[model samples]
Target: MGTQERLDPQAGVGTRVREPWVTVVWNDPVNLMSYVTRVFQEYFGLARHEAEARMREVHEKGRSVLSSGSREQMEIHVQAMHGYGLWATLERSDG
Candidate 1:
């Protein structure tokens, strides 16, 4: 199966549905786990437990999906993460 396409009523043309984009934070050697968790909490407004879980995922799995939304929002998130000294990237969601 594949993603569904939709017709834009106004434009009267077919367009692929917009897929959500995700901001991914990658593990790095420089930042401490505690710091990463704190950043996740502060920037993403995530609960303490949730932030800690994501931090652990980045530590063990090499990366973690921090947020999912429009591509522009994900870009903003990636930029914020860079400002905070965390490695991050954005990509289309698999779903």
Candidate 2:
């Protein structure tokens, strides 16, 4: 089925469908790989293997998309990651 578009009165932008946003965590010198994996498991409830994989991705690739959803939700995820001492940011999902 086709997606529906709506006018956002607050932004005053033209009618458009809501786009997904993503929370990205960047590799940093401070947090260890184990810590990153644990954070992913604790905060995002990812399985151990999945969390480790994502942690490895950040370690090897510099960053990883940890979660995707509404902009507000992604913002929350980014904020929470910051609270955990992990560098994080949110952006519009490319796909």
Candidate 3:
């Protein structure tokens, strides 16, 4: 067998369990654009322009990844979004 065909026992050794997550904000007619922008700014501490940008992305694209991190962090973000009365959900990131 060629060297490339050999299995490396240490290939995945000691690798951290990275649990990627996605924060999805669904389209809801009830929330106002300004309110959404405020929520993004308040909850995530995003700058005014950045917050509005994400809000616009969500409004235009039907959804946006407000933030991404570990599962625990995502859960926190999801709950925070809920606290702001915005439609939000978390899912495993494909990456």
Q: Give one digit per residue, the lDDT tens place, for model 2 in 1-95.
A: 12347778998776756557889999999999999999999999999999999999999999999888778788899999999999999988777
Rank order (by lDDT, best first): 1, 2, 3
Q: Give per-model CA RMSD.
A: 4.5, 4.6, 7.5
- What is the descending TM-score order? 2, 1, 3
Q: lDDT for each of the candidates? A: 0.91, 0.90, 0.83
Clashes of 2: 0
The weakest ten consecutive residues by lDDT in model 3 span 1-10
Model 1 C-alpha lDDT per residue in residues 27-61, reported as the tens digit of each score: 99999999999999999999999999999999999
lDDT winner = 1
The CA root-mean-square deviation of candidate 2, after full C-alpha superposition on the true structure, stands at 4.6
Cα deviation at 44, candidate 1, in Å, is 0.3
Q: After superposition, how far is residue 92 of candidate 2 from its true place, in Å?
A: 0.9
Every model's TM-score? 0.83, 0.83, 0.82
Greater lDDT among 2 and 3 belongs to 2
lDDT of 1 at 79: 99
- Model 2 regions lying over 4 Å from their true place: 1-18
Tens digit of per-residue lDDT, candidate 3, span 1-95:
00113334679444444466878987799999999999889888999999999999989999989878777788888998888899999998877
